[model samples]
Target: MTDKTLRSVTIERTGAGHFTATNARGGEIRFGTSSDPDGGADFTPVELLLAAIGGCTAADVDVATGRHSEPTGFTVTVTGDKISDELGNRMTDLAVTFSVAFPDGELGDRARAILPRAVKTSHDRLCTVSRTVEIGTPVTATVADA
Candidate 1:
């Protein structure tokens, strides 16, 4: 097994409900909840979570199929259902649908055959975001003095 490395992002509140998350590499992503009046400018955290899953898998599939034939068209739609119980609100189910079109002829057939495997590999082992959600990764929170 490869050695495990720590990955982290720092999130800072920019406004009442808006925040900015910065990765170790200094890349930043803005996020907010629907309750925020300015939330329309950026994706909400929940939406970002869904995007992470879809984007990860899409990238993997694209690379996998590139070996056989480039896809003429590619799109992914990810949807999640939210449920509220006495405990709190959480996502109940998520669905990811991929629409891909390959070039006509034998190359297209080859790409089609590889699509399932690509998706399987991504969901089962390659996508860190989806795998973490699927396996229930533990998250610990603590507050530090400013």
Candidate 2:
């Protein structure tokens, strides 16, 4: 078996119930406690899961595209289904929709073919959030032709 150490992140309240989350790598994100019945002002823990997956997917696409001759900006849309009961809510399934736009007459069909591969690589290997969810949650993706 391989040995792995748990990574740590620290969260501190910067103001009245508002906070900042800091990772071991020094990356920080803002978070707030909720008071609104509309569920605004707070970054619900569940939302972070989606953001984690989406962000990783986007980064994966970008990195993979960069290795190719024609790299372009990419967008990813993710929708998730959650289960709720007296216990709480948990994600049940997730769908990631990718919309990739390349410059007209870009790098021809080759780049297009490679794009899909990159996205797959991210989900298969690079995206921690996606893989974590995949163990218990269903994950799906659809590629858009540019």
Candidate 3:
């Protein structure tokens, strides 16, 4: 078993403007700064950030509500404005909107009723990604060998 206190991924340069990040479990995602003849279908770092924010909460809400009933239509849209200011380059006005619908009747009613709370719980206390952004943190960067 691995330590649950820490989670990490290793990123390596595949070529110019493109890179691959691999988690400890070996899940890999390729991304690049831009889509040129070389970029392929890879996602940009900003998109990944948005995904992480939305994904973390989406997972929490899904598990919370899914226990009661499955959603007929479920989608989470995360939007933000990337700006360069005193904070340097960062996303602002972040929003995670969930468009979820459940079937008719009690099972659906139960899920629907809890959806708002589930989303609120995630935003307030559960989602690590969003929480980190909201609370803020300092990131130190250095060359490992240095």
Candidate 4:
């Protein structure tokens, strides 16, 4: 991966009721004011941050499983709850949970030995987004058979 940094983004009104957001490199995102008229048109940056964690975790799972010869596929779901300050204002803390699903077949001992390390390495060392969120949020993961 290159040492690319997402420095800044720009948002502009593009239509009668919509707006477009663009990054420094010309990457654009479109949104509308329908959701929260006061809050603004696109998804909040916090929402995008959650998405980044989920996407990175899923991708790491795929690669880790393949590297381990598991050669399987899985689905991941991430959920978060936010805590606010005394004034009933903005979020002060966030708790993030992840659920990972694997195939139904039982691999017994083999899976038991490798799965934990795969997940640990991904969250503890590899995934950039997970590392980023771990800075301010409490992140946890649960693995299940599907």
Q: lDDT per model, in order?
A: 0.89, 0.74, 0.93, 0.62
Residue pairs with clashing backbones, model 3: none
Q: Which ten contiguous residues of candidate 3 have the minimum total lDDT? A: 33-42
Between the candidate structures 2 and 4, which one is better when assessed by lDDT?
2
Q: Local error of candidate 4 at 111, Å?
A: 7.0
Off by more than 4 A, model 3 = 35-39
* Model 3 lDDT tens row, 85-136: 9869888999999999999999999999999999999999999999998999
Cα displacement (Å) at residue 67, model 4:
3.1
**RMSD of candidates 1 onward, in order:** 2.5, 10.2, 2.2, 11.0
Query: Over the stretch 74-94, how does candidate 2's per-residue lDDT look in tens digits?
Result: 678888887897868677678
Residue 38 shift from truth in candidate 1, angstroms: 7.8
Model 4, range 25-136, lDDT digits (tens) per residue? 7998776645465756566555666667777866776666655445444555555655676766344444434444444455433543566676778788888877875776
Question: CA lDDT of 30 in candidate 4?
Answer: 74
Candidate 4, residue 140: how far the Cα is off, in Å: 28
- Quote the positional error of residue 12 for candidate 1 in Å: 1.8
Span of ten consecutive residues with least summed lDDT in model 4: 89-98
Which one wins on TM-score?
3
